[model samples]
Target: MSPNVKSNLRVASASGSVTDRRHAFADLAKNEDVHFIVGDWMSEYNMTTRGGGKVDSNGGSEEFETSFTEAFLPALPYLESKNIKVAVNAGASDTKKLYDLVVREIRARELNLNVAWVGGDEIFDVVKKAAADGSDFRSLTTGKLLSEWECDPIYAQCYLGGFGIAEAFKRGANIVLCGRVADASPTIGCAAYYFGWKREEFDKLAHAFVAGHFIECSTYVTGGNFSGFKSLPSPALSLGFPIVEMEASGEFEVTMQQDRDGIVTVETCKAQLLYEIQGPYYYNSDVVAILDKIKIKQVGTNRVRVTNVGSIKPPPTTKVGLTAKGGFQAEAHYFVCGLDIEEKAAMLESQVRVALDETKYHCLKFRVNGRCPEDPYTQDAATVDVRIFAQSRDESALSINNFFRPVTDTIMQSYPGATFAVDARQAIAKPYYEYWVTLLPQSSVKHVCYIPSKGLEISIPPPTDTQDFLYEQETYETNAPIDLTALNPTTRAPLGNVVHARSGDKGSDCNVGFFVRNADEWDWLRSLLTVEKVRTLLGGDDTGKPIFRFELPNIWAVHFLLKDHLDRGVASSSTYDVLGKNLAEYLRSKWVDIPNKFLDRGRI
Candidate 1:
């Protein structure tokens, strides 16, 4: 253990996103003896729609997460009584508003709780001026210049680190709200402040960063988004929020409430560790976490211990997301029932294509989802959905009459057993935002901590000792490649029968990570699940997209990153699986030859 810390610091997760259950903070405050309650409220897509972001064009009432405000207010007295602090990025855009509102509430309640906020995340005007000054705004993904982008930029926000939050806590603030500090930074700030950790404590800091990430999604580490859903009781029940007990030694234990229906295991922890990461190097403004040598294991019931998380200095540049008006989109679904599913879908698509002015729209697509079995027992099972999805920059081109009716009008003239799903909700074109993530020099960010009690806005200095390296994954080869011919009898089965996976979207790219329970299967898994295999499993979605694959042998897992998978960001995506949440399930469903012996061992 680091000599500076005397005991373990307990940090509990309160909320995952803006829409996550509000009872989390109160529940944790009433039940757990935690020093800090940290949670994240923002997703990349959330910014595109919420206040002070893309919504600037459209009038927004409050311009912050009001639901989270309600959740935090009720827990204030309990938190103050227990001397528990809160560190969160719930200040989606306007931290000043959030700070004022929170401070008002605290004073109104006659509570002595102090309030602080971190800002300088908003850099819309700065970026615009820099861009106009001939500074290259190149795309991190395609390496194309920002000038080439069809969409005009409106808002730009840099991802801040935890230093500001740490400063807030150090300055005697009970609550630290942030705008766009990286999601896990709240946990990093809490652990750092409690341990009195310095900037040079990369190893310890990296572990806290990962620990924050594990429980950042609240119940994710507690088997909420876990692949072994069926293995736990009450799989569909609302899970208890996660709490991480951190030590100065850079090790932490993840666990949830005993009464709630959620399980904390090694598998669940691994699942969250692999989620939404672009590569092995997790870049943060404070410290870049290296997951290559990380270790996780179930130490006790409802407890999983994570250790040995490696780290390097912060990347000189951090992610900066810029959002712009992408335009409008609307879709109408037509359910074709019973026989001739393919023929009916083809006929509908052909008619819809001719009826709609494809040239006027940015993307006009007809997608056919699912299929009717040779003889489906029920009507629901026998139906297939044919969707006419439309997107256009011009509002007039995507009006209900232009976009919706063109597809719905063709229903009577085309296909049999045609019942279309179109209503006032789906008929109108809703505006969407295009999001792009790129790297900006950390020096450019004006990140600061505002301590209301002290009336100070202390600017945080970017790390001086930083490394410059391409964000990449290193392949792990712990054992010799398995010879398929010598393996157990092969059977055609869903890959999920043995391998379990977790998949999520990071910007336009998708990350899918697969793991196994048995140690022996680790070698086979790394050797079997390659980039080519991932591409093949993805089918049309692959489309020669660049894929980065790596192995996490310590966790018995192989991870694949499919780039440019989502058609732009989720806010403007035309794909049905906009968030790529189902990528793992879709990949697992693909028939693959698996060893009978492993199958006999039972599926994940």
Candidate 2:
């Protein structure tokens, strides 16, 4: 049977985590009209940690293969009954192994499911050759060349697009597995395949791109991990994964399973849209999506329609993630409570400095968490955790027993109310990785889809319109501040009291975007929140880092990007919020002047 080109394409995301979400996948299986199901089982942290290990001959990791078996085998019967095609990037480091596993499971059940695998995103050899040829693989975060890196990369993988998966579906495959493709690529591929969208349909592709981005994180657009959780429906535990009803004209409606415990509204859709986006131009390997003019409207109960998405030319190069063994890291935490907490913390720090030599470690940090209240109601209120962490290339320097003995020796002579947070001996040293993100030419990547039954292999090439690799930094002039005296009365409150924000990490940098509910608030937001204002809000966290601010008029949002703020990315960063997930909440807690007029209009 030929696939329909004019019908609405219904694509749903089943799982978002690296581990199995049996309930979510079950929810997907129960749906009747879902044309396709997608899952994202890989994250940047997962790539750096689990993806660094050795690969078997079939190019699969034991960890991901186990996860795939546990998550998918149970749902296979249901998926086959529904005749739903599956597209997932769960293969991670090993697509072939996953493909083989799926085929074996289907054959044992006497099912006729056609499984395909997409490969060639792995580019360790290409990166090696480029580095050897004196190619300056400059770091996207630090601007340092690859040659300057101290550690050798264990693996390097470029992000592939969805066209290859689309090709696999075109060749009559029921399941398509991929490695290291963009998270949204699965939805993009499914939509393109169903709608017969041409490669040159930039506008349609842009719409699918945004739709894919929204649902890519599974329940994100359906109220999971949302800031306004209180505003959502009750029983958020059984939140449903997202589904997009994509039209042939590039418009889509975001919805979720009616039986689930989540709601889809304009607020949730807007929040997910702002998550992890850098600026107006969101660059994907296939298309550069323009987000400044995006529009979201609540069309019905638990349904939001997104439209007006734009796109520019696709970049010639895709981002390559390189993970290398950094060194061993170890840390221990101590608690100081009751009166004179600051004095006690200082005394403990002094004792540690005198007991241990700082020169033995490559990186050392003494961080204090929680503030000592001036007038405490309880001991816990006045307690603060002091953590000491050290990392080094030398294994002995980070050893649990040797490195902590000096700190333990001071317990007898330590300050008042000093105590270890937990058993100090439980702290163990473990190897970490340095994430080096750079760009690789798209042409250097070989994208191929393999269909075992048909004994076919298809090659997917880069788009002909691909341009040369270019990095253009967007610059915006600071808009003049609104005259508070000239306007109506105002009240001093936390910026979040009147604004909605979402934040995420991009390598070592963090991006925080603030959106307003109405035009009046947007005027105030655009005028009030500048790069300088953002730095002020960040306070000591800013550390004089380079900050860039951009304005999106259509969404009434302001976005700020702070560079080198997350230390050395998630894997090697010593900070508690390594992924920068809490950065927006922290900013929302900072007080800002809000115009009384906007607040009176129920903008908050």
Candidate 3:
């Protein structure tokens, strides 16, 4: 560590994703009193390709996230004027390409900023060669081999650690562009560089990782997408960006400006911490965070102190994501209004199945999205959509004549009040990507940091120390059978009346995390909310899917991880909630018997 360690470092999270506020970086540099800024632009939901492949809303051209150009171009001079350091993974598929774009702009502006780009994220060709050598590429979620996948793999991008970013900062690079680095890596890199922490400094590195995780989503830690969003006086859309005031001891505080919207409290911090995490052990390429013992408390208005985060060495394997064409999918909706909704949906599904010759396609399904009320006032309320969806490898099966004609031709034959919620023009088959999450050895990554001004490329090797991570989650149960009658003064109501939840997708797996407001409710939560109870709450939709339960006692939370729940994942999911974001709300809506005493305390 440095002799004169940085007393305090102020770091801000600029943009959460491609769709986040375009003026975030500029606004921060011009208005905020921060020394460093980081942004994460890559997401599993959006698939970007290298070279002349995909160039659309999903991703940017030149093999990187071009959407960042407009957002960043105006912020460059502001960065020069304010002298703030930046690190972002906006170089989606191509790091060098985006690096050149930034360098050209810097040259034109005559700014003193030294630019750098990180490499080793793109490993498509390497994996392809390894697959040919009879190496196993089994999925982390399904345990299915890559050979078993029906489609050909097009791209593979590995998530790198923060060491490369640290090296870039050490090499005098004022601005760094990265490809597919982990979301929290930016914060970790900034803190490591500022505080002179080594890669083996597991405790400090892990603490930085937690801070990175909290603020990486920009407004997430600032009340955006919160279950208690209505409690905030300001609208959820106008949330202030997050800031982490980190100290040399690895202690940090999460807060945002009060002038803007959003609140930074213990609950919002806990909510963001639990988002997208599968278990108590949160992994990164550099370090693994032991989250069960972490502490978060409100120190002042819009400020929360976080401490006691535990850590261990990184795992030998890192997460690798590959995108492949999963054939074509299309959907058409027929509205069944008024009475006989079930019979109408059933009749239409049976008619369409035969008409479309569903046997020719990979999979065809008829699903009733919403229910028609028994006695409704409006036609919309009395309507339910019977969706006819199909996926097929053979393009002919999804063609307009074959796929569209079958559903449209059945209008006259369908039951009463049959109409199309989806039009004919939108029913044409569109290509979707299937994202696969798998583990790759860290040794496979030849991580490097390139500083263009200095003409230097520093090799950042993989960590030597690692622990064999246990994928299993912690389990807690009653030692003996207890009397349900003792606490039996209960009332049947929606679980949301007493609990709050946040759910998100992780490839084929879905995590629905539920929490309470205080420790009093925590006792009732951990006892009553079990895997079996959660399965029942899912209403048999998960079927035979395995649901794993775990608890975060410090946060008064219980998490349920459902394996293979999203089928092929968000990009190619057949379900209506493609990202599985609504799973939490769905679980919250399920009826649960709450004790009258606990109910009297006030709802979450």
Q: Highest TM-score among the candidates is held by which one?
A: 1
Give the runs in model 2 whose Cα sits over 4 Å from its true position.
1-4, 55-65, 374-377, 477-481, 598-604
lDDT of 3 by residue, 127-185 (tens): 88788877978787787888888777778888899989988888788898998899999
Considering lDDT, which of the candidate structures 1 and 3 is the better prediction for this target? 1
In order, how many clashes per candidate? Answer: 0, 1, 0
Per-residue lDDT over 1-604 for candidate 1, one digit per residue giving the tens place of the 0 to 100 score: 1225688988999988888999989989988888889988898887766633435645445567787887898898899889899999888777788899999898999999889999999888778778888897767665567888888877888899888988888888989988888999998888878888899899889999999899899998888877788898765587889999988877999998768988898989989998888788888888989887889988999999999898999888888888888888878889998888889999998888888888888888788899889778898998888877888888898887887778788878888877888464776887888888777888888888999689898999988899984755564433576786567679999998888899999788888899999997777787787777777887877769678877777898888887778878687888888888889989988888888889998777
lDDT on C-alpha atoms for all candidate structures: 0.84, 0.82, 0.83
Q: Ten-residue segment with the worst summed lDDT in candidate 1?
A: 51-60
**How does candidate 2 score on lDDT?**
0.82
Q: Give the Cα RMSD of candidate 2.
A: 2.2
- Which runs of model 3 end up more than 4 angstroms from their true locations? 1-4, 48-61, 471-484
Off by over 4 Å in 1: 1-4, 51-60, 469-480
- Rank the candidate models, highest lDDT first: 1, 3, 2
- The estimated TM-scores of all candidates read 0.97, 0.95, 0.95
